[model samples]
Target: MATGWAGDGAVQDQIDATVKDGIQRARSRLPSGPGLSHCEECEAAIPEARRRAIPGVRVCVACQEARDRDAAFCGYNRRGSKDSQLR
Candidate 1:
């Protein structure tokens, strides 16, 4: 049953974790409710089009971009496998 060097169930575990993470990520991106008129982060005006389009957008495009950029550089790795930690 073991295919990889990690042993039996390791690959399956990794696949399960990846699928769970994907589901969580997708859920997080789901729209919540009515959109806010302003950006919660920067207090910038949220355009009507964006609000209507997104349905629950809390941050303006610029603020959201900045947040995404910071998040990318924050080094918060969600996939912290034990094998990686041992290395």
Candidate 2:
């Protein structure tokens, strides 16, 4: 049961929308076609095993790690407790 100004199923609708958006964002980031020998961002060697493991791998682990650190949170867990939100 929705309280306050929220209509019936409004919270669920918002949650569904958030999940859809996250899925789209993740799908968009995925690499396509053949994998590259070197990282696209830094031009570092991607290592033979990595290219084989991830079919369309684009960036090396170091560059990917940096990118990950830059965008650490995707805001997908906003419904958590205050402490979780802070983290």
Per residue, candidate 1 scores C-alpha lDDT tens digits across 3-75 of 4366677767777977887778867876788779988988889999999888788999998888778875322
TM-scores, all models, native as reference: 0.51, 0.57
Worst 10 residues of 2 by lDDT: 78-87
Residue ranges of candidate 1 with Cα displaced over 4 Å: 1-24, 72-87
Model 2 Cα lDDT, one tens digit per residue, 1-87 = 566677888768867877888898888887778999999899999999988877799999999889888986646455666354233
lDDT of model 2, residue 16: 86
Number of the top lDDT candidate:
2
